[model samples]
Target: MKVAIVGAGLTGSLLACFLARRGLTVTLYERRPDPRVAQVERGRSINLAISERGLNALRKIGLVDEVMADALPMKGRMIHPVTGALDFQAYSASGDRAINSISRGALNNALLTAAVAADGVSVEFEHRLVELDSAVGRMVFATPAGKVSVEADVVLGADGAGSAVREQLLAEGIVAENVDFLDYGYKELSIPAVDGEFALDPGALHIWPRGTSMMIALPNPDKSFTCTLFWPAGSFDALTSASGIEDHFRINYPDLLPLAPNLVDDYLNNPVGVLGTVHTLPWQAHGRTALLGDAAHAIVPFYGQGANCAFEDVVELDRCLDDTGGSWARALPLFEARRRENTEAIAEMALANFVEMRDKVASPVFRLQKQIEHTLERLLPGTYVSRYELVSFSTTPYAEVQHRVHRQHQLLGAAAVAAAGVLFAVTRSRARR
Candidate 1:
């Protein structure tokens, strides 16, 4: 079958490689110029923290080692409070598992390279998808040359958020798309290396938690850190004047003020990215055209799972095809039905994580509670596991992870109540004496 895949980002390029490996002719259409040659898109976050879910997909094509070569291993979250010592929350008790911080552009370029190296995959750059005919499995693109229509037996929309294929599908009455935008938005900031050395610990994800806003930094290969600042939409406008801008950071993220030398320029120049959850019904359009990755679901990046989950989609769809004999008619619908619940659960959890990350992390009581939870996980072995571990480590579906976390919490509550009763009895005996 001839397949057309849109958006040569991570998911699109990876999916093209998988399909091409299966002996299908694949044409990848990307709207942007070839990313390797063109200057990197300014204001976008450069790196991503990839874990097991995303690594598994890269491993399929034997590109895991190649991809991990430049990765910076972050063993845990390093919280940078406005004042005081940094608190390190260990991700693994044994320090074995780690989320690799790698450049997003590098990963995409690697995948694009892998796809182009494959036998049957071809990429068409500077081609913007304008429309699609799902019934006939044809995609129309407005190229630099002219308008061109490419016919295929199958077309996969691996496009990113704001997908043209998803829009076309909605226009054709094949799917319904709804977006739930968060009130909070994010902007990019940077911390260049101090004297050619990383200013903070390079082995952890750095976070500066403010009650209403937060600043996070992930390490890059260049010994610098990319800091992302989150705030309410239009809140930054309050900091328009030079003094206001400096005062805002001083009050909320005092430590960052000294570390970021180019803070003012970055604040004035950087773009603020909107966060949203996308809901779509029936990702498949009559079995001829189907949506994958962000085209089907665009989620917020709180849990750092947006890119990871998208890569996992390519893996799942490939599995579904394997089980269904490569018949997209059966595979597409089944993939949608099976993956929808999982994605929805993760979407809710990711939002909840944002609250914990920004506000709760700064609370002392909340830190003690986490210590208690960590102790239980260490003692109970198989009986206890953290919500983060289940979501990031185990191959269990996202829906199942939520279920397991609730059950584990219930057990922990029961144990706590019994211990409280014992303490009360002992206290009464001591009082009688």
Candidate 2:
């Protein structure tokens, strides 16, 4: 089958490679110029957290090692409180497993190169999807030279949150879209390397969690850090001058002041990106076209699963094709049937994680619960796993993960109460004696 994949970003490029490996002719259409020659847009890259799922997808294409070479391992989160205290939270009970911090641009370029190298894959630059007829698998692209139209056996939209293919389909009444935007937005900042070395611990993801606003920093291959500030939509307006910007950071993120030398410049120059959750029902349309990744369901980045979930989508779609004997008609519906529940589960988890990262991470009760969770994992092994572990370190289906996590939490709560009651009874018996 001839397949057309839109948006040569992370999911699109990776999907191109997967489809090509299945011996299908794949055409990857990208709106932007090829990154190999074009200058990357400034202040746009938010570094990605590649967990087991994402790595497994790259492994299938034999590019895991190539990608990991440029990645830094983040073993845990280093919580930096407003009181200038640092608390380390290990992601796993084992303490050895870690998520890799890789640049978004670097990973996308790697996937694009892999796709272009594949036997049946071709990539077209600067071809924006102006229109798509999902029913007939016909697509029209506006290129530098002129308008170009192509016919495919299948059309896959990996374009991203603001997907033109999806928009066209929605216009044609192929699928319904429901978007829930968060009141908070994010801005990018940088913490360049100091004296040719990382200023903060490179082994951890740094976070400054205030009540309403939070700042997170991830390590880059160049020994620098990419800091993202999640704040209220109109909060940036308050920092009009250098003094105001400095004061804002000093008050909320005081410890990061010395580390972020270009804070003021980055804050002033960078644009604030909006956060939202996109819910589109029946991701596949007309049995010839389907949506994946952010194009289908874009969730907040709090769970660090946006890219990971997209990678999983590619793998799942590939599985669906196998199950249906490579028939687009059967596979598209099966793909949506299998993945919709999982994506929705992750979406809800991602939103909940935003609250955890922003406020609960600083609470002593939350910290104790994490410790308890980790201890349970260590003692019970496979029988008890934390939600983060199930989401990040395992291939458990997202919906099942959520279900298991909820049950585990309830059981643990009951066990804790029973233990407390037993202890109280023993103390009362000793007092009577």
Candidate 3:
């Protein structure tokens, strides 16, 4: 089968490899020039935290080792509060398992290279999808040379949050999409290495959580850190002057100011990227064209599952083809049915995690709750698991993770009530005696 994939990004390129492995002819169309040849666009490349889910997907294609060659494993979150000593919260009870931090650009380049090397796969850089006819399997691209047209048996849209293929589907009335933009925005900054060594602890994902806004830094292979500030949409634009930027950091992130040498320049010059969730009805169209990854459902990055979830989409779609014996008609619908609920569940969880990361991570109550959760996980062993562990360390489906976490919370609440009742009865009986 001849397949055309829009957007030669992480998901699209990875999907090309999977399709090519099945002996299907695949071509990847990318709007942007090759990243291997060009510099990455500024203020947009957020470092990715690849967990078990993403790694499992790569393992399937035998690219896990290559993709993760430079990844740094972060065992826990290091909370940097405004007025006290730092606190570290381990993600797992045993404190051994960790999420790997890797650069988005680096990972994408690796996948693109793999895709190009795969048999029966071709990539066309600088070819933007201008029009797509799902019903007839026709596509037209606007390239530097001129207009280019291609025909395929199937087309898949993995073009990300602002997918042009999705726009064509919407315009042709084949699909409906709704985008929910967060009032908050994010800007990327840097924490260079100090004295040829990592300036901060490289084993943890560092977070400076303020009540309404927060900053997080992840370790890079170059002995530096990539810091992202999540703030109100208006807040980023409010600080126009150098003094204003410095004053804001001094008040909200004093320690960070010293660590980031180019704070003022980064803050003043870097663009603020919007954060949001994209929801679409029926991720596939006529079984000939379908959407995956951010094109199908784009969730915020709070849970660090944006890329991981996209990788999972590719794996699941590939599995659907296996189940259906490589019939696109059977596989596309099945893929959408299998993924919709899980994607929605992850979307909600990611939003809730934003609150936890920015506001609750430093709270005493939240810390106590985490400690209790870890204790229960240890005591119950297989019977209990924290939500973080389930999401980051296991291959459990997102919907199942949500269900299990809810049930666990209910059981814990009931046990607390029973313990209180027993204490009350003992006190009353002793007083009467």
Q: What is the C-alpha lDDT of each candidate?
A: 0.88, 0.92, 0.93
Model 3 pairs whose backbones collide:
none
Misplaced by over 4 Å in model 3 are none
Candidate 1: residue 285 lDDT (0-100): 81
Give one digit per residue, the lDDT tens place, for model 2 in 1-433. Answer: 7889998999999999998878989999999999878987778855888999999899988999999998999999999998856999999998988999998888999999999999999999999999988889899999999999999988999999999988999999978999999999899999999999999999999988898989999999889999999998898888899999998888888988998888889999998899999999879888988999999999999999999999999999999989999888999999999999999999999999999999999999999989988998889989999999999998899999999989988998899999999999999999999
Q: Give the best candidate by TM-score.
A: 3
Q: What ordering of candidates by lDDT runs from best to worst?
A: 3, 2, 1
Per-residue alpha-carbon lDDT of model 3 for 60-142, expressed as tens digits? 98999997889999999999998789999999999989999998998999899999999999999999999998898899999
lDDT of 1 by residue, 52-85 (tens): 8888889998899999999999988889887888
Ranking by TM-score: 3, 2, 1
TM-scores of the candidates are: 0.96, 0.98, 0.99
lDDT computed for candidate 3: 0.93
Q: How far is candidate 2 from the true structure (C-alpha RMSD, Å)?
A: 1.2
What lDDT is reached at residue 202 by model 1?
93
Per-residue lDDT, model 1, residue 99, is 91
